[model samples]
Target chain A: SQKIEQNSEALNIQEGKTATLTCNYTNYSPAYLQWYRQDPGRGPVFLLLIRENEKEKRKERLKVTFDTTLKQSLFHITASQPADSATYLCAPSRGSARQLTFGSGTQLTVLP
Target chain B: GAGVSQSPSNKVTEKGKDVELRCDPISGHTALYWYRQRLGQGLEFLIYFQGNSAPDKSGLPSDRFSAERTGESVSTLTIQRTQQEDSAVYLCASSVSGDPSNQPQHFGDGTRLSIL
Candidate 1:
């Protein structure tokens, strides 16, 4: 069985600073990883995706890194703002077209 | 029309009752997925639908839970004899296909199920 772990505690950071969240997996080798932002009471919204062969992926101020060797992925929000606060989830999937295994997610709070 | 849509934004049902939640995927998407998010827990994959058939149902928790899709568009997840443990937000997502790389899934607002 495959398992995914993420930072369980909420991350409080000052606005305009960078926030980094980590996602680690065990007993699985996925072909790609995805990041999503989920607001309270709302479903997750896709943010970025990075393949196993890709080292990094960036969209706007969001950046995601995939390290197959470490079995980990890091999601970074640069120039974080209050609006950027949300629960960040990392999903790693194995096959080309299959369901993804998601982590519990890290709640990010950007304080002004 | 633009994004995945789920009905009964909130569902309040009594234990031992049955509940049906609906999901309308994007117009052209061929893959649909159902998930449950319990309080303080991560999203748990319930089932996946490709076209009109479910190829992966490994995440369904029990026999009481079942889902069906038709016309490769609308999907309904039914819970029979629901229990308190079945209380969670039911989310639906769809994508062009479940491509492992670069394909991002769009999610619906979700149906908040509260079993009392």
Candidate 2:
């Protein structure tokens, strides 16, 4: 079965701690992957993009790692704040510039 | 605003009625897309447009759903004989280019459609 999914549906962590979310794919290898953050009642916001050739990408306190061999991507938020609570979606797509599908996402809560 | 814009943020209509939702993507963006997000579910792609043309309409759920873009800027999604099952947030997004490898999509707040 061809699928890209986040391992967890929801996760809770203490503020200032490091939060990690995982996305795994089967039966396919995507050339790149992107992560988005969505708040309730609002559209998703673009966060980061990682290519397969690259092992990891980082911006600010966020880091994303892509492993083609394992077909998995890990998104990390260091120094997480309560404001960081939101659903994070992962989109792994082929080189095509057409429609892009996304995983259901993992809702993260940073408790102060 | 410099971001994508969607009008009639909320709409309530009786089932079987025809409805139209409009989207104004950021100026200079040539790649536009529409998606449906049901409560507690992930977004489902509805359609994709590059400039004034749509290369992929396969994601559209049915003939009842139709969309058009003009001037490569504003797009409208019209659903005829709307059903209760169509109650969902309709989202619109646009990118500087069609390639996801290089561009990130900027999304609007979405239109919340309620079928009575």
Candidate 3:
């Protein structure tokens, strides 16, 4: 079975610090990985996406690194702020499946 | 332009009652998807629609749940004899295309359904 594991525990960090979240998968290698931010009572918003061939992708303060060999992806929020406090989800895409398998996600709290 | 939109941000109904949820995808988006998110859980894919092709209903939990899209526009998800387990946030997302390798999905605020 294909499984994606993310840190279920909440992460607390001070504002302006870097927050790193990990997403590990088992069973098969995904063609691409994506990160999303979801707030309470709202749907998820796309953050960044990284392909299997590329090592890293950056958008503003967000960065995503995909390591197919280890079947893990790392999501980083640089200079985080209180507004950045939300649940971050990692979804890996299977080849030609047209659907993404999402992980449980990690709750991140950036305190001011 | 408006993003994906769902109707009845909050819905409350009694068990065994039938309910319908609506989703209006982004204008000109060729692909649409539906998902369910339980409290403190990850999003579960429910179905996908692309162009005029047959929908992918592989993720539907049971036959009691069904969905339909017409003319590549609005979609409605119907739950017959809804059970308590059907209570969850139903989300709708739309993308430029159904190909996951390229297009990214844009989501709606979702309709939070509660069954008593």
Candidate 4:
């Protein structure tokens, strides 16, 4: 079976700093990977999607990089704020229109 | 204009009781998915619906779980004789169809089920 691995430790970063989270997959090579932000008591909201071919994707202060060679994807949030404090999840999927396989996720707290 | 909407944001029931969770996907979204997230755990895919038929149900945890969708619109997930372990937040998501791989999913806030 396929599995995803993310940073197990909670991350605490000061405001305005860059926060980077990692997602690694094993036993499968997906066509693309997605990142989502989830706050307490709420479902996850889509953030960015980076394909194996594209290598990198950016949206405002968020940037996602996909390294197929390492079967890993990195999600970066620039100019982080306290509002950015939440759990970040990564999903790796293939076959165009299919269900996503999500990682356990890393909880990041951006301190003010 | 609306995102996915799940009814009964919170559900509390006694063990062995049945519960139904509803999801209304975004208008015109052909793909709908259901997932479960236990406390401190990641999302677990429960089922996937394309239009009204399910193409993948491999993630359903047990025979006690079943789901149905009506013409790319509303979906209902029912748990029969649920156990205490069935307590978790049930989330619904929808996405547009087309591309071979890169479509983002819009998720609902989820229905929190507590089995006592």
Per TM-score, the best of the predicted structures is 3
Kindly list the per-residue Cα lDDT of model 1 for residues A34-109, writing each as its tens digit: 8999999888999888889999988989889999999999998999999998899999888664677789999999
lDDT of 2: 0.91
Per-residue lDDT over B56-93 for candidate 3, one digit per residue giving the tens place of the 0 to 100 score: 99999999999999877999999999999999999999
Give the docking tier of candidate 4. medium
lDDT of 3: 0.91
TM-score of each: 0.96, 0.97, 0.98, 0.96
A104 Cα displacement, candidate 4 (Å): 0.8
Candidate 2 C-alpha lDDT tens digits along B9-74: 999999999999999999999899999999988899999888756447888999999999997789
Candidate 1: give the clashing pairs: A97-B98
Report RMSD (Å) for each prediction in the order shown: 1.3, 1.1, 0.9, 1.3
Residue pairs in collision within model 2 = none
> For each prediction, how big is the interface RMSD?
1.8, 1.3, 1.2, 2.0
Docking class of 3: medium
Off by over 4 Å in 2: none
Q: Residue A81 deviation, candidate 2, in Å?
A: 0.3
Tens-digit per-residue lDDT, A2-109, candidate 3: 999998789999999999999999998888888999999999998887888999999999989999989999999999999999999999987687677789899999
- Candidate that beats the other on DockQ, 1 or 3, i.e. the better one: 3
Q: What is the lDDT of residue B92 in candidate 4?
A: 95
**What's the best-to-worst order under lDDT?**
3, 2, 4, 1
Model 1 gets an lDDT of 0.90
What DockQ do the predictions score, one after another? Answer: 0.69, 0.75, 0.75, 0.70
> Which ranges in model 3 have alpha carbons more than 4 Å from their true place?
none
